[model samples]
Target: MKRDERSIRVLLIEDNPGDALLVEEYLEEYILRPDLKHVERFQKAKPLITDGNENYDIILLDLTLPDISKEQLIENIKHLAVEYPVVILTGYSDLEFAVKSLSMGVSDYLVKDTISSLVLYKSVLYSIERHRFIRSLRESEKRYMDLFQLSPAPMWVYDPETNAILDVNEAAINHYGYSKEEFLGMTQSALCVKDSNEDAAEKIEALGSASDRTIQSHRKKNGTIINVEIINNYIYFKACKRVIVLATDVTEKLAHLEAIELQNKQLREIAWMQSHVVRAPVSRLMGIIDLMKTGELDMAEKEQMLDFIFSSAEELDEIIRDISAKSEEAFSDLNKEK
Candidate 1:
């Protein structure tokens, strides 16, 4: 089979054998030979539709069939849970009927007498193409929706002039503690703290000017404030210019930084005490011992001083070791925290 001529399994429901043969001949004569299946009545088509063994790409239905009304036949085929494009083939030339068929979910309508091989091929191709396009659009939309809903950070789009939220994702709704509908109804000003010095108008204008990310604080629903890093850019949606703001809550992160700074200050004080105040007495004792060893005293004084020197030296050694251990431990703790 050619690429475009891959057998398009077609279910043709027409009581007229001549009409069925004509359709088959058209299929074979055309450059695209669609694999055709003939069902003389709606009753016969029902099994093909329900069996699950046969897969038809398109259903060509004749409205004036003996077994069932066009509407009933279409509905019964749909009830079989088979999803394929159906084109209505009718002898009736009533414009109202054609419109009704379209409204009833028929993909296209063709007048039986005017049908040609080119028309048949084109109609099938156009219907299949259209169906594929619609399916693609729906799948793309679903994927976008899933990602938006499952995002870890808050995201929103708003009208800058009114400061009104136009749209918010699921994360935004959860983070702000508001329903999706409620969030959309809220204005940006409402999310700003009452005592905030940040001007809402100025911020909005700045947001419009921003090419990518900006940081700001937002008020939560419970009247608490949160620091948010906002990424904003201009977007044209439905012919309306709007700003899309993607906000990440960083209040906890800021608090963590502050806590780390406090810890660092305390650690510095401990290190200073061990290095200077605690080491000063030990240094003085060492100096006294050095003077005795340099023969700066008489024998009797030296003997008495030797005992003092040894005692002082032992005391200094213990203090020095203790200070060293404490300093090492403090540094290790600091490293762990970092």
Candidate 2:
């Protein structure tokens, strides 16, 4: 819906009847006819504003309410500013206090003697718009905070320059075995297990330019080293440059991959033994049997051929045993890995 065409609900708290009438007339002059509700005392206005049943777009408040002291009124206005935009109406005598109240969370202030319809309309409209923008910004920040805290993967924010941990989530605290207070007290490099590739400065530089991921060794509170894939992104958090990190533990995954590769190497060796070692003895037996079947030898020569056959058979039996033993060993290793 269009902003100007929308209805505005305004609550005016003023004791003087003439001043309240002037405000109602000024709001009526605008094309947008605000549903203006007038109350003479601060006590009466409090329940109307705070009851939740009546939602107000903006509040036009007289700085001199009969039931509320100046100091108490200012305090009340500050609390109301969180829920509604408030514009102060005052005489020239209270002009200084009105001006000061603007800093204390009053959206705007206007002197009643010189107030015009145009000025009042602008103040009310502008205050409501500005308050809406501020509320939206706060809500967006809250949603981001929720996502960061509730994520399953370990997440943390750190200062890029000093490498100091700024904030960490519950997952990060649990995974790293550190309390939130301990994590904040330590630098980012404290969690790192220094090794050949401990180039944290260079990695932080890369992270500042763009989102990146790197594999590194990290140590837990218990001194156990773990492999982690860290994904980093640059962010401006709470008006300061920071880097957010998400860590995934890849220790078990990498170990499983290495085991599979070793199993493949063993299987290849077994296949080679079958093709080369097993083939030699089987071929020798075949040649010796063919010679015996020919029956073309004398008694002594036949006995010699028989000896050759017996020797080839023994060799083939030993080769078969070796192949069986190696096949069993390779399978046993694979099963243990699984």
Candidate 3:
């Protein structure tokens, strides 16, 4: 016969053989198959639990065993089977203790003498399903925690009302140079540079109406300013309103862009000087040469005119050299700092 994947695996800790056989018969009556392991005393059950090889769905305790009985039995079972839902099966039920046991995390309190097959089956099924749901929820929370802590980028969660930081991931601690304890005590405003938090807060609040992504400046723990692209969202967590923040460090990217723009500006200035300032000297030299070619000056005057022409030519050469130096400086200074 093919085994059912949904088959319930149950551990029954009962000292009475008759009661143990009865519980098995009750399980057989149910629609679902239950793999039941019966132990007559707590000692035998202890090793099965401690071995860690066996994974039981639910535990049924008689609350009275030869080696361990009554309150001690409940405590011992709970200590050993932390993940399993514990159902107390006692021949005598004390109403006060039953209520208290349930409050202490016991799944069900059953009176063995009056327990019918249907009631026993239902209780086991219900407790197993409820226990599984709670376990699944814990697993979901762990998955989210792993994603946050193991992320390559910084992330944090904070109280939306007080702006107090609630939790920070490992990535956030490493990137921000702050310990986890220090981060928890600090408020979100501490991270932002003065006057920058306002616009970011407003955008974060707008996330409730619609999503917004913003780039803002923030100061690190060591007072180094950084540019970050922030994306935030409002979430209801643990019965409190909170915001989850994700940031990407873009300080280097912005600096690189600014350098490119500066280089372009310097190049434009050089171009203008080459076209305008150099023309003035060249025009003077042309006019002086024209006078000499027309024989407008005597030999001694021509020597004086040659001096003027030489001066203009030198001025033009200086202008071209300055432009060359400026172009070189612009290119050299643009080396990316990051």
Candidate 4:
């Protein structure tokens, strides 16, 4: 037989020899070749459960055992750290006891006289499947919880309609200078500068309209404002649709970019001025000097013209030097600030 075709292992805890035989016979007749291990008392089952030598998928536990009462027997078996599903086999049809056993984590309760062989097989299958599902759900929830709390960025869940803060992570508490309890009491409006309330509201409205992330400014508890890029989406939390906001502080990054843009603009302006404005006057003086050297006029006129050309050249050179000095000083100040 294939691995899946192999018989299911069952641990039968029954003190009555006749009932044990009946259970064995029922499994043989109705269940498809189940492997059954019979234990006459709860004490005998203890070692098997603790040692983990036997791998049983289900346990058919007699509620009233000679060695231990129904409650005590279930509690002791639980301490053995076995995770197999347990179905209580009760001789009496006690609804209260059945409910109590279920509350104590018993997978299912079966009254021996009432439940047919088919019903018993179905109950066992259903109980095992249900227990597996419950365990899987708990493990998934734990993983999500770990990621939610341990993330580096500030994250929160808030009710969009009521504008109530529902949840916050550790990064938010640290960044905003507020405790998790304090942040819960405050709305998004409370985290905005008084003057920026309208801006904040408009941004929030835009977020609600689109399913994409957005950038906005937020104010901290200490009155310090920060530029944050928030990635928000709608989710159903606690039976209601809410907004999940994952915000990262981008204040310093934006500031650096803006500063770089301003510096580039200033450098372009200086380059334009140097290439056009300062060069034009210097070129004119050089042309005048070349004319003076050719000796194209009288001595007196030539001397006067030469003096005029030299003075003009001196003035042009002074102007160019002044421009260069000013440009260098401005760039130097920028570098110092950097």
Q: Find the candidate with the highest lDDT and give its number.
A: 2
**Per-residue C-alpha lDDT of model 2 across residues 235-288, encoded as one tens digit per residue:** 998789899998888677666665666777877887887899878877877887
Which pairs clash inside model 3?
A: none
Output the better candidate (1/3) by lDDT: 3
- The 0-to-1 C-alpha lDDT of every candidate, in the order given, reads 0.73, 0.85, 0.80, 0.75
Compute the lDDT of residue 207 as modeled in candidate 1. 38
- Per-residue lDDT of 1-338 in model 3, one digit per residue for the tens? 33334688889999899999998888777735788999998889878877889989888987767887567865775564457888988766465666567766788889988898789877987888887887798899999889888889999999978989998998888888999999999998888774344544454444452335566788888888887778888878888889999987867766666677689899899888968898898888888878878986878998998899889889888998999899888988886443
TM-score of 3: 0.78
Which residue ranges in model 1 land beyond 4 Å of their true spot?
1-5, 13-21, 31-33, 38-53, 62-83, 90-92, 96-107, 192-212, 233-242, 279-338
lDDT of 4 by residue, 163-248 (tens): 78989989889998888998899887666543223344444445363434455778888888887777777888668999888887
Model 3: CA > 4 A from native = 1-6, 31-33, 69-82, 195-211, 274-312, 336-338
Q: How far off is model 1, as Cα RMSD?
A: 7.4
- Model 3 worst lDDT run, 10 consecutive residues: 202-211
TM-scores, all models, native as reference: 0.65, 0.82, 0.78, 0.74
Q: Which residue pairs clash in candidate 2?
A: none
Q: Which TM-score value belongs to model 1?
A: 0.65
Best by TM-score: 2
